[model samples]
Target chain A: MDKLIEAIARSGNPSVVGLDPTPALIPSQLMPTPGKDQNTAGTQPAHVDDGDDADRARSLADAYLRFNRAVMEGVQGIVPAVKPQIAMYEALGQEGVRAYIRSCALAQEMGFSVIGDIKRGDIGSTASAYASHLSGVPGGRGSSPWHEDAITVNPYLGSDGITPFAQAAEASDTDLFVLVRTSNPSSGEIQELKTEDGRAVYECVADLVSEWGRESIGEHGYSRLGAVVGATHPQAGRSLRARMPHTFFLIPGYGAQGGSAQDVAAMFDDHASGALVNSSRGIIGAWRTSEGYSPDMSVEEACDTVSQCARAAAISMRDTLLAALDAR
Target chain B: MDKLIEAIARSGNPSVVGLDPTPALIPSQLMPTPGKDQNTAGTQPAHVDDGDDADRARSLADAYLRFNRAVMEGVQGIVPAVKPQIAMYEALGQEGVRAYIRSCALAQEMGFSVIGDIKRGDIGSTASAYASHLSGVPGGRGSSPWHEDAITVNPYLGSDGITPFAQAAEASDTDLFVLVRTSNPSSGEIQELKTEDGRAVYECVADLVSEWGRESIGEHGYSRLGAVVGATHPQAGRSLRARMPHTFFLIPGYGAQGGSAQDVAAMFDDHASGALVNSSRGIIGAWRTSEGYSPDMSVEEACDTVSQCARAAAISMRDTLLAALDAR
Candidate 1:
């Protein structure tokens, strides 16, 4: 978190680019057509006769890495961090995960903080295992498979799950963000439930998260354990800001998810340095809706278009957030 | 779930062997000595000159797979299913995940159901992506990298996160278990909170899970959507069993986790048809205390010792569980 805060300061940006690539988001020229790359890997499962799914997945993984590399090229210096949503890569299976790690590694190489949006949580011992995403190998050392600076955690299993991650984060000089109030539509089903003591479930979670971060306050006056307060809940985010004074936030659901800059403004601190707003499709997928993009473009041309569009979108988002904070 | 229920009845065992291999859990001889396996891959990061960590991880991954293969061979006909906790493999990074996938694939090949203990939760869109563990490649076809019969999911993100998994389960003819009352010491922190309506949070979640299962009732009087009720909490487990009638249960926290057969018996249905208990260290690591084990044994002999001990421990557990059910 100290490193992240410093990176944010160095870049002069309070936003993190979300690298979430899907088949739908990729250019047609980049994907391996049915029988083309299918000859590379082992045979497909007997259930399907089309081709080797593993090989196809590998091709997609490669395409995704290329797509990510282009997008990173676009937003390299404008954004302080990149949050690679693991789910997208995970859909492709192991090959997809390889791409995800490579993407994170490339991002780090380009001098950007990497946040793995892997909402992974489990029991105590298992949580320690998942903490390897931060702490690297259990017994061995050096670079970990997943080059993530921080990762998002789900706290449903209580302290038994989170403590291991916190310990790992401390050991690795990394950080974690607990899911406090997500931006999803049905998040209120459990998070907004009022307890007997007159506090919402998310509020209790906020207090717990604040406690989780109490011992690791960085020089930036924010804790290494951050909170994920969706930009959709502006009023709740504002109140949560006041409640968890020392906790920084990674605010998602902006732009494409309908969270306006004005909606996210209240989530920031007086210096506007406490929260990092994220926009995945709004930036990375911006080329899809851009007039400059054409389906007939070559692979390099399409990637260049995506790069420029994503860069423009990222810059616009940064400026919008800055203006919103200034107005506040 | 239908497949799992049938397998359980056929084997006359409602137990799933948990494959949770760790460095501490594995035999010292299995790991590649620091410099022995370092030549296979590129040099390690310049930070520490301590050999290639990736190669080390790959070797550990292979060792874990071998260990799991031995455990599976031991419990093959005795146990109906195997639950591989992905975190242990994930701790090693991508290679570890490869081992996990291969383990699942091998288990499926051995005619056993595989439950992936990946408690992944996220927003709606992201959850849909994670559902790929059940539903293979997004647009692609054929076998998934993860050969899981079912997966465990976290319900912290509410319906938005769970619905996708349920949909994927239905499509793939697989199943999902949602965390209800976990077995950890600090589980009560959030799970036991009393909502304004006087229901504990887990009960509310139980009702939600039951509702999530309503549309997918299988022939066994259970749903593809299941509940993870720890064996450590008998009273709560009994109530939850009554609460989620349509849902199946994957009970963890047995043996090494302090869950006795008596403690878990009440969680079963009248015919002992609705639940499957899991024991990881107790069964898989039984060789540690076996009189037949010797440090001088070869890898094959060690694995053989592990196999026989695991089989014997698994048989003992089955008998103990059946006796408890009979008493109930």
Candidate 2:
């Protein structure tokens, strides 16, 4: 946790680009060609060509890997971390998951912390398995497969569900970001519901995050266990910041999700080191909507422009956040 | 949901064997030999040889695949469904995920409804991505990769997080089991907290689930949207059943987790068709701790006995559940 905080401080940025690669985001040249395999019986959906499924999955996975590698190179110095939402890779099946593993590896090799955005939660043994997977415990060939500095976790199953993850993080010297107040439009349907004690569900979650972090405080005075409080709710962010003094924050909902730099300013401490504001589509696909970029460009041409566009977007976001911090 | 209810009715059993394969549960011969991969630089833990990681993961995954297939065959006629917990596969990385895909495919092929026990939750786009993955939308070569009939989801992010999954279920004519009262020891830490409106947190989530299922009710008077109420808390399960009459239940925490047939009896409707009880470790690893089983058995001997042991366990659980229903 302190390492992440220090990185943010050294880079003069508290932002992380979310590498959520979808088929549409990949360049046209990288799209997989249809496979010729014919073994389409059983659970493979009728819509897909059964025989060539593995080949196609492998192709798409490769495309995503290339795209992610490019994006990592583009955003190298502007951001302190890269969060690969596991679901995106998961959607592509095993091949995509392998791409996710490789993507995390490349990001770390490039000197950026990797946050595996896998919102996994379960009971005892199941939860332990997930924690082990993240921390690389009982790893294959004596090494963990996916090397992530931190991983996002859901707390719906409560403490026992989270205990295994906490223990894994403690043992591995990694970190955890528990979901608290999400940035979605309908998050309040449950998170904002008032409790009998006058606290909202999110507030209760924030308190738990604070308590969970107490034992894992780092040299920077922040716990490795953090809370994911979305940037969309500025007021909630402000209150949660005050409540979870020891807990760092992973603030999503920035950029395309409608959270501006000003909206997330309260998430950080006075030094602007307590939070990492994430922008997925905003950075990765910046070339699509940037003023100087054109959608009609050839695949190779567009690919060449993505790095510059992504870097520009990261710089812009970093400056905005820094300005917000300065003003506060 | 109606399809699931019908399957349960046809089998005269509302139980599902959870295929959560672990290394210990796999026969000794299937274990992967140590790999020679040396790519372990960067964040990859120093303890593992990175060079042969993929091969090792593939070996482990193949072992798990064989084990799951055997279990599916063993429990084919006795259980109405098979729930593959995604975590165990995820631990092995991409190859493990492939095994999970094949496991679900095999179970479905064997005529058992598959419930993907992937407790995934996220906001909007991410949730939609997960849903698409579940439904095999944009699957490799245009076919869905996994063939699950239903999936378990978490509801911590509120309505927005669940909406995408519900939408996907509706579109695909499948089902969803949203977490309400999870089958964990510390579930009450948040689930049982009192809301200001005089409802517990789980009660509030139950109301939301009922509402989500309203538009998707099927012929059996049950909606495709179900609730996961742990068998560990029978009283809570009973009340949740009464509260969400149209919603079915995926009851976990049986056998190894200490929930008896009598304990989960209330989860079912009068016709004994509203729930599917899941027993993972109990059914899949029955031979490991069974009376006649010994660790000293040869690998081939253990493999031969696993199916019989699994079958006996399923038959025993089925009888116990039927007796409980009859008494009710």
Candidate 3:
């Protein structure tokens, strides 16, 4: 948490780039031309010549890596962290996961904290296994396969599931963000259910998240255990800020998710260092509508367009959030 | 649901061998000898000669695949299904994931339904991406990388996270099990939080799961959306069984987790067609205590011991469960 906080302070940007890649978000020029090797992303609906399923996955994974590298290059120094959503990689099966690790390793090399948006949760022993993402493989001599500085954990299974991750994060000097209130529309169906004590389920979970991180508060007045409060839930985010003061916030659901920069202003502490807003499609997909992008451009030219557009979008986001905080 | 119910009926066993392998659960005799290619399991604390992290994961994944294949062979005919908890494989990284898919494919080849215990959940597009486990990769010509007949999902994100999985399962003629009442000790943290409506959170989730699966009821009078009600919660299981009439159950926490046959009896339907009880370490690790097992034995002999002991333990589990249901 200290490392992340220091990075955020150094950049003076409380925002993270969500490196969540999808075929639709990638430039058409970057996709492989048809009738070529089945190991590249193609515009022809990823039709594999051979009936090899693994090849299809490998092709798409390769394209995702290209797009991610472009995006990572785009926002290298502007953003303190980049979160790669594992779902996108897992979609391509193991090959995509390999790309995800490469992306994380690249981000780390470029001096950015890598948050693996895995959201994995299970009971006791299994949770310990999932915590390996933070702890690295047992006796691997400090070789972490999944190079993540932090990860998002699901709290549905409660303390037994979360403790292992928290312990691992502490052991590795990494951090974890527990889902308190999600950005999705249907999230309220469970997270907002009013409890017997008149508190929403998210409130109870928020308290638990705060308590879980109580013992690990770093020098920056923030704990390694953080709460993921969506920007869509601005009122909830505002209340949670006061509620879990010691816990930092991973605020997702800005831009494309209907959350505005103003909506996230209250999520920060007085110093504006208690939260890091995330925007996936908003930042990574910025090249989608960029005027500089042309279908006739070569892969190298298209990649340049993507990198420039992403950097511009990320800078705009940081400025907007900072302005919102200043106005507040 | 129809396919799974029929398989269970064919075997007359409401049990699924849980293919969850750990370093401790795997026989040491089957582990690779020290100072080999460093591409296999070894008793030497997995000390890699070089600093190659990938090699470390590959070795552990190899051991897991071997253990899983042996266990699959042992339970092939007796059990209708096998649920491989993904957390164990994921601990070793992407190589572990490859092994996981191979294990699932092998189990399917052996005429067993593979249930992937991947409790994955996220919002809309992300959930859709994760649904690739059921629905094959786009334009792969029906090539499904994750060869599981069914997969588990978390319900904390509500219906938005579940609808894609349900739709994909329906499209692929597969099924999904949503977490309802988990078997963990601290499961009650948020699950049992009494809502203003007087129903616990899990009960609400149970109702939602029932409604979500209402349109997908199969020939066996069960829906594609199943509930993961832990065997540890006997009372809750009994109530949920009556509550979710059309939804099937994937009961975990049996055997090694302290769930007894009597505890899981009420989870079944009147015809014993509604649930599949899972026991992982209990059956897979049975060789550890068997008289036939000896560290001095060859790999073939050790695997044979694992097979026979796993088969014997799975049979005992099936018989105990049947007797409990008959008494009930």
Candidate 4:
């Protein structure tokens, strides 16, 4: 808990980039030739022939890998970590899956922790299998190839479903970010169900996550286990922070999802480092062309600008949160 | 329900073969040759060194594909369908994934509907992606290399998570099996939670499954959507049958998991076709010399005996239930 907090405090930003490689959004140059406009997504490029499912899937995987590698490599010293949404790669088929693995490796190589946003949940034996697949490579020592440093898990199946993941994380010194309060509009359907205790289901889950992190406390003051709390729900985030004091927050819904820096900042308590605010589409772009900035600006320049914006929002929120803490 | 009842009445059996391809259970001859038991899962005969993670994963995948194919081919006419557990294949990595696709295709060709036991759950957008990935190809029509006739889903994410899967099933004339009361020992941790309304969470999920199936009623009196009610939970299974009259049941925990034929027969609800009882390890190699099956009995003979035992149990149950119904 303390180590991650200390690291984030030293870095001066609580920014975490979400790598959601929407094929349609990849820049033109990055797209394999002939597949150039194919990457543009909804826009129909002229004289373009749609490839077979396998080929399109292959290209899509390539696009995802390229974009993810670029971001991880580009933001090495800037962001604290990268969360790769498994859905995006999964939509690409086997090739996309291969690309996802490559990207995870690249992120690790670039000195960033990889949070596999898989949201997987199951019962007993199946859950154990996933725990092995995600954290422990079958016969090997140390980290597994199919493993992630941490993964986003679905807690609907309850504590038993979470136990195996927690055990695997502890063994690997990895972590889990169970979905506590998701960013989706429909999350209220189940997550907000009123419990006998008067707490919503998400709150109930938040309390449990706190308990799960108890054994994996890192010297950094953060536990190896965490929670996925929506940055979109500022008030709920504030309340959950009180319930789960030691848990790390993977705050989604920032930037393109409509969550503001101030909203995300509220997730932190006294320390500016407890939350990792994520932005996917809001950043990672050929921003110069889209924003009509100078065409001469390099990819590095665009990333720097994106980083500046994300960092500014986080920093301002941290200051506001600090002021509130002091007043209290 | 009427159509399923009729099918069971005709077939005179309620047994289902679960395709759980654990690498450890693969036959020696079918495994890659030239390797000793000390290396590469002790099953792969070839690629003794197994070399890197990629190589070991590939070898394991080959074994899984071969095993699943043989099992599907072996039990095609005898069993109603093959319930392939997705986790087993997923553990084998991408190559195993390829094998999974091939096995599903083979099963479909053999006139057997495939029940993909993935147990996946997520928020709306991602849920849709999984539905598309499992039942159809991901990335729209013809974009995926593999597709199943039906997939098992988790209901923790609530209505939004389930809707997309139902919609996908509707579009493809495919089916879905949502987890209701899982057979795992610790399912009580969440699924058994009692609400103030006096309904357990699993019961609420069962109600939702029934409601979702209303949109996909088949000509056979059954809906394409189904529920995964573990055979181990006979009482819950009986209760679920009453609640989900039109939905099919994919029942796990037969054989190796210790649910007896009589215990599972209750799931059939007198008609003998309401549920598909899945036995993974028990049926896959019942005649194997290593597993202590009579060495004199051929594999086919073993399969026949097991299938017949299942049939007799189902028929006895059917008659008993029918007599009770007639008395009423």
Candidate with maximal DockQ: 1
Which pairs of residues collide in model 3?
none
Model 2 per-residue lDDT tens digits across residues A30-57: 6775443324434445454444766767
Please list all clashing residue pairs in model 2, or write none if there are none.
A37-A51, A38-A51, A48-B142, A48-B143, A142-B48, B37-B51, B37-B52, B38-B51
> Which candidate should be chosen as best, given TM-score against the real structure?
1
Instruction: Write down the worst ten-residue block by lDDT for model 3 chain B.
Output: B41-50
lDDT-wise, the better of 3 and 4 is 3
**lDDT tens digits, residue span A151-241, model 1:** 9999998998999999988877899999999999999999999999999999999999999899999888999899999999999999999
Per-candidate Cα RMSD to the true structure, in Å, reads: 3.1, 3.6, 3.5, 6.1
Tens digits of per-residue lDDT, candidate 1, B57-79, equal 88899999999999999999999
Off by over 4 Å in 4: A1-10, A28-51, A285-289, A292-328, B1-13, B28-51, B134-140, B285-328
CA shift of B260, model 3, Å: 1.1
Ranking by lDDT: 1, 3, 2, 4
Q: Write the per-residue lDDT of candidate 2 for residues B122-219, one digit (tens) a residue.
A: 99888988886555535443445677888999898888888888888886778999999988898998899899879999999999999988999999
| Clash counts for all predictions | 0, 8, 0, 15
Judging by lDDT against the true structure, name the best candidate.
Answer: 1
Residue-by-residue lDDT tens digits, candidate 4, A1-328: 4544554666665766777776455654444446433355555333333254567677668867766765665566666677787767766666767887788878877777677888877776667667765644354333355546778887766777889888887766577888889887767766776666677777777877888788888776678778998877889998888788788898888766678766776787675557877776665643423454343556555445544544444344445544544454
Native contacts kept, each candidate = 0.75, 0.64, 0.64, 0.30
Error of 1 at A290 (Å): 1.8
lDDT of 2 at B229: 92
